[model samples]
Target: MPFYDIYSEDVRCGRGASKSGEETKTAEVFAGDEVGFVVGRSAMEPLEPHLIYHNGPGQVYLSQSTAADVREYEGDGNWFKISYHGPTNDSWWSTRDQTGMNFTIPDSTPPGQYLLRVEHLYVRYPIGTTQFYIACAQINVRPPRNGTVGAKTPSPEYMVRFPGGLAVPEYMYEWPNTRLTEYKPPGPALWTG
Candidate 1:
């Protein structure tokens, strides 16, 4: 659950380089646009046969807050929503194997300042241990050119607490187990908005 700001640093530091700090850079995205991140050293392999939708060098989420200033955002309200990839699991892959990953910005998402959060979850390595590599990128969400905002709205169903979201199963953290066909992603359900 240790959080960083970006992934453009030394690999020796591992995912620690993305941790949030005093300084940060902002990436801009329109309400409806495709955004992707280059597979940097921050990527990690999953412990189990991860579903493509949940697998990642890390999961990318969007929030209006920087995630540090809790005074402005608190409780479930501070939560960030997963950026929609698509209907299929085509975007899923081992962060270690892929060059990058992409997702579409929903037109319904509110336009404002946001923090693009990237998280890399590792369930192996120590065998039965779980580690997380999280990074946040500052972003500004602009309205679509037509000026018509999406009808859909963000709701509680799309929110989940960071440190407490993933409740790992013994099969997921331990190696050599059954291959699960269905998987509920660690956090709350995907917010279409």
Candidate 2:
């Protein structure tokens, strides 16, 4: 029940997560669905995809009866990275040629509402000019085809908050440094479930 209105939304999609996200248009998906993550791009960079849930901010996934009993999935900093696309060769990023990304909702995820989050960092200008683009889509996940649900949400060991999760060097500059053989995006590790 903390403040979910990320001011950045003001320049984009605000108003929804401002209150009790329950009012937001929640997209319904099955546990094993292939969820696509996209946030139009003007340059070649990297994007990280994540699925997040909140069970009373302290509780754990208990049952379908209480699956969606929590507030809307918004900015709680609690989330698991589903996937990420970053530099491939020195001159390009693997996601550079694509308009969006396709990711599967973890099959073992408990049935409930979640926030599908995507983050892209633009380091075209290097230091002080880099930009960060973030988008979160609200979703309600049901059980899989087998109708099985996990006893609990993935442990906090695999989860990380947003702002604090992506703590990278403020002076990160990747323009000429594009030839990265090792690229680790600025967030939590990927939790495949």
**Cα lDDT of all candidates, in order?**
0.51, 0.49
Candidate that would win on TM-score: 2
In model 2, which regions exceed 4 Å deviation? 1-23, 40-74, 124-128, 148-152, 165-177
In every candidate, how many clashes are there? 7, 2
TM-score of each: 0.63, 0.64
- Candidate 2, residues 1-193, lDDT tens digits: the string is 1223223442122334436456657788888778776444334433443222110101011112223443433454466766666656655655554546677777877777666665455543323333444456667788887776562466666666534422333223433453443445654556666
Q: Give lDDT tens digits, candidate 1, residues 1-193.
A: 3333222242112344334333555667887787876533423755544332323235667656545542233222345556522213332334544455577767777877665665555533343244555545556788866778763556776765544534444554443322322334556666657
Which residue pairs in candidate 2 have backbone atoms (N, alpha carbon, C) closer than 3 angstroms, thus clashing? 77-161, 90-179
Model 1 spans with C-alpha error above 4 angstroms: 1-22, 42-58, 66-77, 84-96, 124-128, 173-177
Q: How accurate is candidate 2 locally (lDDT)?
A: 0.49
**All predictions: root-mean-square deviation over Cα?**
7.7, 9.2
lDDT of 1: 0.51
